[model samples]
Target chain A: MDIIVSKDLKKKFKLKHGQRVNNNGVISNEIVVLDGFDLKIKKGEFLVLVGPSGSGKSVFLDIVGGLSTPTSGVVYLDDKIVEAPSAKTGYVFQQYALFPWRTALSNIEFGLESRGVPPEERVKTARELLALFGLSDFEDRFPYQLSGGMQQRVAIARALATKPEVLLMDEPFAALDAQTREILQNELIRIWEGTDTTVIFVTHSIDEAVFLADRVAVVTARPGKIKDIIEIDLPRPRDGDIRSRCEFATNRHKVWDALKAEVNKAQQDWKLAPAFAS
Target chain B: MRLLTVLPKSRVAQREKIISLALGGSVILLFLIGWEILFQSKIVNPLFISAPSRVVLAGITIIKDGTLLHHLGISAREFALGYGAAVVVGFPIGIILGWFKLARATFGPFIAAMQATPRIALMPLFIIWFGLGMTSKIIIVLLSAIFPLIVNLQVAMGTIDADLVQVARSYGATRWQIFRTIALPTSVPFLITGLRLAAGRGLLGVIVAEVFGGAEGIGYMIQYAGSTFQTDKVFAGVLVVAVTGITLDVVLDRLGRHFGKWRSEAAVH
Candidate 1:
């Protein structure tokens, strides 16, 4: 049985402002953000959703993580229909989103505290988690005191501290520099390999998707739909050599081909008027 | 020995030390000279604009009379009670209105209207309602202080960093936990700022209330002294008010600085 499943998921937002000049006037039309998107994840599998900007990848991740409600269809986590964020599913946001007011250890312990973990045990567990991430010395330091890469590492540690069955990452390393991104990507693979948690990672970077995922799901442009699912068949702990391999190039090309036309079409439909025209 | 050697070794440190000492000494000297000149010149009626010497004499006289302590105590008590009440009431209401959409929609406009109206104008009404007693003075102070506290808190809550809130929610924090752990800690600086602002307003409220109608307080003493042409006593009362305001402001400022260390740490990255 799939650990996570989204069936016929649909979400639409009303575009109306909160104003009514006439009683009988139509408010506004609805804008569809996600339309009949379907996906499923096997237990402990690393799945990546790859798409262009505004293709609703984050929205889809939010739906799966129960951070958002779908207008239609249902999302089941371990056969339970998810209605709200739970301890069973950990979410890592694109911005890292570590609590600025909290130190590294405190941030990690936040999830444990919410689950009613005892203070001593929670502190011990958080310490262990930080040690695993090589952040033991920085436990007392606040998020703002750390570099971006370090902050994201803390975010990951915080997410994993709850020991959730599934980890939902919404472009978690997208804001980092290329060097930091690569290092974190490798670190992520190492962490995921050591755990049995199912991972659903979203990103627009094909390289990142290809580097991390067992299967990459390509999403079509706005009013997003699943365009294709490409199995990576890449071996564990992939390093820089994989980027140079023929298989990597072939898979990258395949993803680009599946994505290029949709990306172009989206750009065309959503293009802004030129500010200065000759 | 290392610390002693390091003190003036660096150019930056030496420059800062010299500049700071020079500025401090010059300010003190300027104040002393200005006071001496004012007393010696006596350009205006010395009786009306009492010299620093005469003001000190008046202070000694009030001290002897035992009324100075009583008035200070009364004013201090009024300020504390009123300001405390305002903070206790305003903070929770602001949080409630900020947290709930329905509450905000219903009460937000009313709060805005209340804040916009000049609270001083309600002194007459307050005196009438509560009578010319400590109760009326406190009400006046509360009226002056509460609005700023509520307004600041509401704005702070509204503008809380979305990322922190999201982080708390993802941790499976309930609404209450989120407010306590995330919202409350994040809004500390704003709350302190509001309280500091309210302290000044609270003092003003107390003074205004006393001016309108009060038997014993700084403002009432000043009014009485002015009417009897005891200008030195009046100047002494004015000085007390100024000192109280200044002391409260300085104390709150130091407290803010002490607490603001965490905020600055958060802002650096």
Candidate 2:
């Protein structure tokens, strides 16, 4: 059964007249971020959405995670309409949004605390996840005390604390250095393959989408919807060495080919409004 | 020299601290000596500015007679009550104003107007209404201190990282839960800053109110001494006020450091 489904999802941001839209002075009464966006994810499937900068991939992910509501249409999770955030879906943001004041252990336990999980069980779960992420020793350390990679690990652990059925990640490794990003990507895959969670990850990098996804969904430019869904015919238990394989190159090329026009269209939109091009 | 050379690495830190203390003390010592010499040689009129020796003598006399302690107790009580009231009152209001746009829009102009009005000038009105007692003085301090706390906490709440709140929301945290966990903890550093500003301003408020009308407090003592041309007594009172302000500030600074250890550590990272 499909764990997540969005039926004709549309989101439009209304702006007041003469309101500062972007750095560019392009004024519009409404900016449509998503229009008739639809996707269906099978249970435990690894789906990655690749798109250009302003293609509303993150916006759609937000809608799926229940962090946002679409202007029109409905999102169904487990055949139930999703209207608000719950323990059903876990969200990993682009920024490591770990609370600065909380230590690694407490941060991982945040979702559990919200769910009113008993303190002893919460501690056990957090420690187990911490150990899983190689962060057991740093559980007492605050976010600022941890490296960016470690912080991201804690953020993921925090999101997974409630053991949600679906994990929605929005460019979770975009801020990391290249080496850290690659290492984390491998670690993410390793950790995720062990779970039965349906993953919908969004990114701009075709390499990332091809590597992490079972199926890569390429989204169109503004008023974004699914352009193409490319199947990654790679084997399971994928690791860092997958990137060196010819199959990896072929799938990467296919995803990029599907995305190239949208990327150009998005860039043209930016060029027309030069302020946002930056 | 040999003992110093043989000192351990940990003792070197102790040595550095001692050296710094000595360096700081030397400047005050030189200033005191210069002041004493200037007065003794009659370069400056002793009546205009009393020497450190005379100020000490006057301080000793006041202490022996118990007046200094009495005034200090009264002033301390006023400061404590007023500052405490400001925090109790302003903090929640500030959070509300920051959290809700409607509340901020409604109260923002009034807060701005109150803050802009010179609160010192209202002392006479307070005295007339509440009389020449601790009530008037306490109100003055509260008036001066509350605004900064309100303004700062509001700013802290207003400028909270939207991403953090979103993360909390995505975890199924309720609005109140988000406020309790994310909003309040994030505002700690700002609250401390606001408290510090309030402390300085509250001290000024209390002193000025006492100077204008009170029968007790260091401000009153200083005013009475000045009226009688007792320069030594006036200097001693001024010294006490200055020391109290410094001591309050230092205590608040230590509190800030304790609560905001996470923030300071962020800068290190």
Candidate 3:
């Protein structure tokens, strides 16, 4: 049932910092963010990847979404290597990423337009998706005219419009307020149930990972690798009250425990980082 | 007892408009009255500074003789040829330079240098090559006007977010498709800016060309009347030029607004 398999993935970013004197060039630090990273995502499952800040969770997610290329190693979707971004896999970024110039409905129809869907048909499909997301009346409004939460909903609809087999969301609601974030979590769960697509969601929030994912994958600090993947055995069609349930608190605690060590190490490194420079 | 009555909001808005229009009209009327006072008293010498009434008489005489139309037509034609050609050529070149770094590297410095150099100084060279005909006047107009359009459109192209382009590419959109959907719509405000700047600069250029050495134009008429101490005729020519400049600015502002309504609406944020 596995739909995505990434093996021994690695990424390195070279940072050239400080001043340059006499045209001799400045110093650079090559940070290897991910190495020996391995993961398998099952078909039709909501897999949430949680990691400490700067753990390359988003970077790895981009690689899997075909938005970027790894320094080495391969990520496969149904036995095919993901080489370039295509309509097969859709991505939603942290910043909503809705086109400001486009109206709510037209933003959803963007992917359809790229795929050559006729105007009349794409409008119909976009309109239905807007209604499904409870934004039907705001279809004529631009992204700038919408609230942050409403814009994110449009972003999600835009990602789903092409009917991709895989959806990659990288902290899509990270910019939202706390109350809106909670509401969006429920909407995400609702939307997931309504579709049969495989979702690989990345987040830094423990409560979000536990509340939304079927299984949560915790990653180590820099040079990221999966620390643990915990399966949630909670009852589905779970209502908002489920967050107050004993099992919900337990699962959230479990993810927090796994992530705490890496976070502390990252903070300690951040403090000592200046002294350790080459 | 006089008291202000509270009108409905929309009607009050119209009343505000009327008051504004009245104030705008009074400004011009006051200036005209002051000039007439100064002229009738002969404070600055009547032969040098023409009275408003004499200038109006000169304007009417020129109109009836049909000489004013001929001069204005010549200047208008030169401006149209030069500025129209600049827009047709500068827009695409600016887009190409904006999109491709290599093209920008090659042409950017050259274009900047051309812009910085005073194009009016080239009029003597143009006169020698193309003669003091319509051709020379239009060439000067093109040189003066094209720079702002190119520079503005190029900068506008740069302001488009790279993330938006990446998103479009992620959805399998082609280069042409992406340009049509994203770059073109986004560059509209910049295009309007370029047009506005070019209109002002092109007006200066066409007049300068005519003043320096052109057989017939509003600028030529002014220079001819000034040398002969025909102050009324000179004032008439100046009035025509001022009116033409105001008309151009107003027309361009409306055009810019027509293209920019959606962008401005979104830009409220």
Candidate 4:
């Protein structure tokens, strides 16, 4: 069953660039980020979106999570139109986005707090999530006290505290070292296996896409649309050794082949007329 | 074998504290001795800069007579009320200005102008309006202290981490929740700084107002003694004010360090 769906999703941003253009006072320029972008994420499916820098992978994820609205077209979360950010969807940013003032436990309790869960129940749920993330020892530590990998783990725990039906992540481990990234990727799969949560993860790394995703969706350059969807038939219970497998390399190659032209076009477009907002 | 034995960290810290205290005490003792020697040697006129001994005598006399305590009580009350009012009033105004663009646009320039204007310059007007009394002095203190608190808080509100707000929003938090959870906790360091600034300004305001025209307060005592050429009494009063200011500041600094412990912890990153 399709848990989350978007029909002809389009996002346009009106950004003011440089100075006046010929004194006509036409200070604003509109760039279409996503146009005719369509995708159907199945229930409990692990999907990874890969694209160039300026492509609307992040934007589409934002729209699906209700963090943003499409310029045109519709998005449905469980057949109901998504108009605003709802507790039903959880979003994890690349920068971790853990509240610096809040401890690991309190940060995890944030969504439960928003949902008006009672204090005892909130603490209980947060503690359980913290334990599940293997951060029970660091529950009282603030975000700054935790290492990068640990902070990301807390962020994931925070997002999952509400038991959201879908999880949307935008290059969540992009800032970590390669080894940490791979460890987190495996950790993420293990966690996903325990829940019936649908995840739509966006990343620039083809290796990440091939490793974690059931299907890799390659989005095109600006005015983004899905260029190709490559299926990763790698078996479940995949571990660190999965990255060394021949099937992983082949799937990674396929995603790269589909994404290479879009990346080149995006780089050239950036060089030619760089819109500032993206 | 004994040479290799090292002191524990706490023992080292204790020794450092004792050394610092002794050094600080000696400097004060030396300063007092130098002033007394200057007076005794007739290098400086006692009529102008009274010796520490005479100042202590004058301080004791006022204390025994209950005059110093009386004036101190009045001044302390004025300061407490005024500073308290400023915090109670200014903080919300600042948050409002920061949270609402419309409020800021309407009053921001006027607030800036008032802040730039020397608070002491408005003393005569306050005296004229409220009369030469405790009310006028308190008003002066409130006005002087409020600007720093308001301005700091307003700037703090603007400086909230956008990413944190985004995280809260993703959780479907209400605007109030965002402010309560994100903006308030993050603004704590700024608030402490504002309080410290406000304390100094408030003290200045009370002293200046009393000195201008008042029958009570430490400022009035100093003004009266100076006018009467009682240099020792004047010095005694001035000493009281200095001690009060320093004590208030130290208390605030300790409070800031306590509440803002996370700030220094974050800095380690």
Candidate 5:
């Protein structure tokens, strides 16, 4: 059985009056971002969703994680309907939204504290997570004191501190420099290998999708639904050198082939943005 | 070679602080000297503008005679009571006004109208309602202090990062927990700013209410001295108020810094 499943998921957004233009000189900003989407995520599998910027992948991940409700669909987690946020699901955002007032350890302790874990156990768990993220030395430092990569690591560690069954990451390293991004990508694989948790990641980068995913699902342009799901047959411990391997490039090309049309469609939408924006 | 090395940023900062202090002190000293010279030469009448020496002597006499302390104590108590009431009532109201959309919609217009009205003009109404006593003074201070607190906190709460609150909610934080952990911390710097403004306005309120009617407190002392043409005594009262206001701001600035250390560190982030 799938660890997480979405059945005919649909998400509708009422855009501001200025968001779009109708051909008959009326503003029609009502738009469906996801239309009849279906996805089944297996246990302990790493799934990456690649799509255009407005393709509703993040919203879909949010719905699957129970942080948000779908407009017209059902999401099941472990055979139960997902309704609200729970300790069983952890989410890592693109922005690394660590509380500025909190130190790294304190931030990692936040989820545990909310769960009413005892202070002693909370501290121990946080320390262990910090060590796992290689952030033990920076435990006392605030998020601002750390580099972007380190902050993102802390964000991921904080998410994992609760030991959620499913980890949802939305473009976790999209803001990092190239070197940090590469380093963190490797670290994530290592961390994922050690955990039995299912991971669903959303990103705009095809290379990231190919590198990190057990299966890369390509989402179409807005009013989007899944176009294709491509499995990465590359062997693991898929290290840095794997990008140079023929199979890695082939898998990346496969994802790109599925994703390129949607990107162009999104661009076409933007080309007509002058009429919409005016 | 080590001795010839450049000074660290912190050391340079310390030196800059000393220089600023010296500069500020010199300005005050020079004003005092100029005032004394002009007064002794009778360029300004001694009766109209009291010299620095006479003001000091009057201050010293008031201290020795215990009258100044007595008046100072009354003013301090009135300020404390009024400002305390403002804080006790204003903070939660501000948080409510900030956090809840319904509350903001209900109270926003009323607050805006109230804030727009010059609160000093309401002194007669307060005096008539509460009499020329501590109650009137306290009410005046409360009115003055509360607007800034409410306005600043409301805006602060409104503008707090939605992503922060969303992240907390995603982790299963309840409403109250989110407020305490996410909203409150995010609102601290703004709250401190509101408090600082409230303190100044509170001090002003106490003195104004006291001077306008009350027979006790430093404001009354200043009024009584001015009416009797004892300019030096008036200056002493004025001096006390100035000192108290300055001290309140400095203490608050330090306190704000202590609570708001996250602001400096997280500013660029």
Candidate 6:
């Protein structure tokens, strides 16, 4: 069963400025954050998108999540066109954007609230989810009181509380320290294994893509287009030992090679501009 | 153990306290000395400016007569009516304008124009419409106070961080939920500030309207004293108005500070 399909997804943004700008204002040059991006994910597949910083990976995930409308394209989830944000698609932002005003439990309960889940049921489910994330003790604390890693866990809990068919994450662990990122990565794998939800994780870390993804999609810079898809034939419940294995190194290198050209191009592009040169 | 560790640091804090007290004391002493010299020289008519001593005596006399209490009560009642009306009308209108684009487009410019037009100049018209009763005074106060309420709320709503709104929408919040949970709470600090400003303006409006034509209130007393050339009484009335305004401002400021603390803690996150 197919969970997500993107066909020739294209997006362009027009940069406009100035007063009484009667003109359509020059295209300034279209920024194609996504161009002819195509991908398909099987139901329950853990798909990771890995590329350089400006590779438009986040934009692609946003398109699939329906947080943003594509300039021109179609995204189908569970055979329905993903036109706008809905309970079927859950997005966990990179910044762990938990509502500052809410306690951890309340933040997790937010998605349930949105879905019209009754208060008693929501509280029970949120508490259960927080416990699953080892955050049961911290439920009463505000987001500010929790560390960065804990906040991200709360964010993940909030996303999963809605029980979506697919989870879209954009650099969810990029802000965390290496140790915390590793631990959360394992937790994510564990959670994904436990549920039927299809996961589309976007990240810049090669180890993360290798460890968590069933299939890794590498993307090119700027007008991001999928360069290649590498399927990890590794066994389930991947842990730290996988990193030391030759298979892991080979897959990592394969991804690195697929991404190296785009990375170089992006760096060259940055160098030609004064902003990065300084 | 903690108390022992905090003692040396506490001395530094105490030194700051002592310096502040000394500065305050010296300033008050200098002011009293200057007032005493002015009274002795009789540079200005003692009756007109009123020596500080005579002003104190007059305050005592008014208190004894019970007229001072009556005048204060009347003024307070008028201020409460005016300010309360302004808040009641202004808050909801602000929320509507802030929430609905059409409301903003339709009424925003008109509100701005009303705010720009000085309310003092409208006192005569209000008197004509409502007459020289408390109704006219309240209307003037409402006019003076409502503008800041609307303007602050509109600005607060307009400037809410877009990310927070996006987060709310992503959660599938209904329009009302978004308004109640996010927009309303976020706009509160600005609303409180506007309310405090409106309180002062409302007081000003009450006094101005009363001075123009009113049977009671502190402003009426000031007018009576001015006409009779009983300068001490005029000074006494002015003092009462000044003290009232300052006290109201201080109270509102404390209230604003209390509410503002929540936003600051949110910012720390």
Q: Per-residue lDDT of A26-76 in model 5, one digit per residue for the tens?
A: 557666778989999999999999998777888888887777788899989
Off by over 4 Å in 3: A17-28, A271-278, B1-26, B264-269
Best by DockQ: 5
Instruction: Please report, as a residue range, the 10-residue window in candidate 4 chain B with the lowest summed lDDT.
Output: B1-10
Interface root-mean-square deviation (Å) of every model: 5.7, 7.2, 7.5, 6.4, 5.3, 5.4
Top candidate on TM-score is 5
lDDT at B144, model 2: 91
State the lDDT of candidate 2 residue by residue for B1-269, as single tens digits: 12112235598889999999999999999999999999999987778988999999999999999999999899999999999999999999888899999999999999999999999999889999999999999999899999999999999997788899899899889998999999999788889889989999999999889999979998899999999999999999999989988998899888988887666343522
Off by over 4 Å in 2: A19-28, A272-278, B1-24, B266-269
Q: What TM-score would each prediction reach against the true structure?
A: 0.89, 0.92, 0.91, 0.93, 0.94, 0.85
**lDDT, residue B158, candidate 1:** 82
Candidate 5 off by > 4 Å: A21-27, A271-278, B1-8, B265-269
Model 2 chain A: lowest-lDDT 10 consecutive positions: A269-278
Flag regions of model 1 displaced more than 4 Å.
A16-28, A272-278, B1-32, B265-269
Q: In candidate 5, list every pair of residues with a backbone clash.
A: none
Clashing pairs in 4: none
Residue pairs in clash, model 6: none
- As for candidate 2, its clashing pairs are none
lDDT of 6 by residue, A66-110 (tens): 777888888898788888777787888888877766788999988
DockQ (Cα-based) for each candidate: 0.36, 0.44, 0.36, 0.44, 0.45, 0.23
lDDT digits (tens) for residues A232-261 of candidate 4: 999997888989989888888888999999
lDDT of 4 by residue, B27-55 (tens): 99999999999988888877998999999
Tens-digit lDDT string for candidate 6 (B31-54): 877886787798977656666677
